[model samples]
Every structure is written in C-alpha cells, then in structure tokens.
Target: MTELRISQKEFDLFRDFIYKEVGISLSDKKIGLVQSRLSKRLKALGLSSYDDYYYYIQDHKEEEIFHLISAISTNVTSFFREEPQWAYLRENINTIFASTRKIRIWSAACSSGEEPYSIAIFLKENLDHYKEYDIKILATDISKKVLEKAISGRYVAKDIAGLPKHILQRYFDIDKRDPQAPYAIKEDLKAQITFRMFNLVYDDFSIFKNRFDFIFCRNVMIYFDGSSQMKLVSNFHKILSENGLLFIGHSESLTRNNKEFKTVRPSIYERI
Candidate 1:
C-alpha cells in the first residue's frame, strides 16, 4: 500500500468545505496538515485517496459533517484547566448568584463535561441557597462521542488530579481497584448537568426561550475564521441577559468583534 499523498486539489476542497461549514480557516501551505489530520479516518475506512474519503462524507450528511468537525476541531480541555477563571467565579458567585434566583448557565462547546461539572461543584460549595434556586447547567458540544462520555461523567485519575480531595470524594464514587474504569461522578453531580449534541456553525438559537446568566464558550473559536467569530459573538450577545457574563478562552477576544460586551478582565466579559 502506498503512503497517502493528499493532493493539492483534495486539500483545497476540504479546506474550503470546512471553512464554509464551520468557519475554520486553512492556508494553502497546509497541504501536509490535511494528510496528518484526516489520515487516520482514511486508514480506518481503507480508502486510498483523500478524495474518496471526502466524497463518502459528502454523500452522508449527519455522519460526514460530524466526522468533519471531529477531524478539524481541537478538544483539549481539563477540569479547571485555567484555575484563575474559577477563582473569579469563587470571588463573584455571591454577587452573580444574588442577582438571579433562576441560574441558567451554558457551557458551549463543553468537551467531555469536566468544565461544567467543575462549575456545578463550585456552585454547590459557595451557594448555600442553591437548593432553593432553579439551577440547571446546559452543556453542549459538537462531538456526539465526547458528549456521551460526558454524560457518563466518568474520568481517569489524571483528569481528576486537580480536583479538590473533598469534592472528589463527595461527588465521585471510587473505582475500587479498577484503574481502567476510573471514578464516576455521583448521581447528584450528573443530575445537575444536561448534555446535548450541538453544531455551533448553523444551528438556530430561537429554541432557547430564556436568556442565560452566564455563558462559558471557551477554547473552541480558534478553529473559526473572523466572520464566524463575529457571528457567534453576536449570537452570544443576543442570548445573554443584560449584565450577564461571558467567559471565553484567555487567548480569545470579543473586543474587536462585538461592542455589546466590555471586558471586565482577561477571559471574562460582562454584558453592557
């Protein structure tokens, strides 16, 4: 079998298709980029050419599109990966929770549920009145596979290393001797979050009837082009209530894209 040589034409087709579908941008020089990323799927499917694999995806809508997203997007996150943002939440939860009795928060592009679960634990600790409030966490991701794993709320020991010992013990069941299985999140923590499969590129937001208090859309925008970023920011602006906070990845910015939000600090924005 010949090593896969992703031709220039095939690369261009995929690059344009991904950008149009999900706002990702790939430069012309990224010829080997396509080969390296999509090579696994090609090998698995026993397809000789990138063109053949691309056509297979094109013929099948749901499966193909999702595979495209999985191939193109990066899902590198961990429990409280950026600790300072959680610290901000710790300092401000009282004020934020005080203003709203109904806490509706969204972890957009939430990869594998760790971030939202972390948020849930944070709320449980700080908000003594949490039981009284109508609180729900909506965690959505583009990858169906990751969403299922998230719904299971199971993680290896490494993923839970940063977690506080008490919260880990309280919120998770020990795996006994099975290192392979890891600890599973307790029913209460799992109950606090709801997982859904979502495609951020072209989905309608009208179904979300109520405005959210906080929207944590972090680390996913690095894939999108400038126009898609602007559109997503606009959508976020429309969905968040006045004075609602939007938390983005530390490397991302809404300052240039949307005027409705003013950056309070790094990675955190307040709706103006």
Candidate 2:
C-alpha cells in the first residue's frame, strides 16, 4: 500500500519533475490537486511513497511519461466545443477551402478525437467535392492512451451530446452489436485522420516536412509558462503557410510583443 499524504518535500520534487518533463508549471495552490491526482498513480504502482514513484519514473522515463500526463492534465473536450470558432470557420469557408483544396490540419493535443473528428465532419458538410479533395488531419497528443481511443474512433453516445442531430446521423454509426461502444465514428471518417502520440513539449516538430493550412492548438497552452508558450506559438508561425489559420482557446492569447502571426478573429491567427 502507498501513502496518501504528500509531504512538502515530495510535493516540490514531483512539481518540478512535472514541469521539466511535461512543461506544466504547477502553482503553490495546485499542491493539493497534484497530491490528489498522483495518489491514484502511486497506489497503482504499489510504490511506498511519492519519492519512490519519482525515482521509478526517472528510471522508466520512456514508459511512464504518458501515465504522468494522463493523471494530471485536463483533456476535457467535445465535438464543436467553443461554438464561436466553428461559426467563424464556417463564415470564412470560401477563403479557407480556396486556400488549398488539398487541406492539411493538425489538431494538436486532440484529447480523445472529438476536435479532429469535428474537423472531418465539418469539411464533409461544407465542401462539395470533399471526397475528391486530399483532406488529412494529423491529430496528436502526448498521451498514448487517448491516441488509442482516438484511433479506435469509439465514443459513448453522451460523448457527442453537443453535436447536431444531422451530424450524428451523417457521420456516426451506432454499434448495437458491441457492448462497449454505443456509437462509433464511420471507418471512412476515421480514415481521414491520422492519430499519433506526440509530445509537443518534448518531441521534435521538424519531421513534419509539410506546411499545414490550419493548426487547431486550442486550450492546451494554459499549462505552459510564457516562454514555453512563445516557443510553441513561434513554431506554429514557422510551420503555418501564408494565409493559414491558427486557432487557440478563447481564454488564451498570443499577447507577447511583435508576434509574427496576424490576428484574424478572437483566438484565431493567420500567417499573412
């Protein structure tokens, strides 16, 4: 059995470890949250204490990093989340689809597949020859667990409560045969996306030799400090094509001086 309480020394050790490994800076106020979140991990590993788990993680860094992020990071997302952004995208559909009939979008930190799947559905609904267009969505997250689920394209019916009824009818096929998944994304829609385990903080972005038309990196940067945020936004600016769009969370902003990307709308930036 493992200890439930996190000592101050243990808290500080794990806090810094998380920041260094995952780039998520935990505040003094989050000490309790950290303790609570990691307790489950501690019990699962059968470690004697937080310190033991920390050392275990260091030794098994490759395998344990995903579990660490899964325990603490907030991955709450759904289809068509933040309604304004979708409205804006649809309003500018002509300019967007015109940029390249062959569209490439990256749903960076796509939690469980809703955002990328939403992108797939939106394109199908809007584009007249979407089937002919070379549409590909690169959906990546640090957590392999979520990526597995995303690749499976399975969700409970409640996972899609926010989606429109027509969209539900058009894109999803209910699986009465399976006990686990009440609804599953159609195989063709799942094929439109390529999900992979990618660490935005730790992994190399240079492998992506191609520029993307749209990069939806929404709501995840709140965990990053300013310097980290600047580095990521600058990378986004570098990889995005001229006139390409970068959509961030409504609460987040690229407020740092002389940012290269031009602001198009709330939480939307363009590399113009």
What value of lDDT does candidate 2 attain over all alpha carbons? 0.86
lDDT scores of the candidates, listed in order? 0.83, 0.86
Off by over 4 Å in 2: 1-3
TM-score of 1: 0.93
Cand. 1 Cα-lDDT: 0.83
104-137, model 2: which lDDT tens digit per residue? 8999999999999998998888776666789889
Model 2: worst 10 consecutive residues (lDDT sum): 92-101
lDDT of 1 by residue, 190-244 (tens): 8879999776767888778989999999998766777777888888888998899
Candidate 1 deviant stretches above 4 angstroms: 1-3
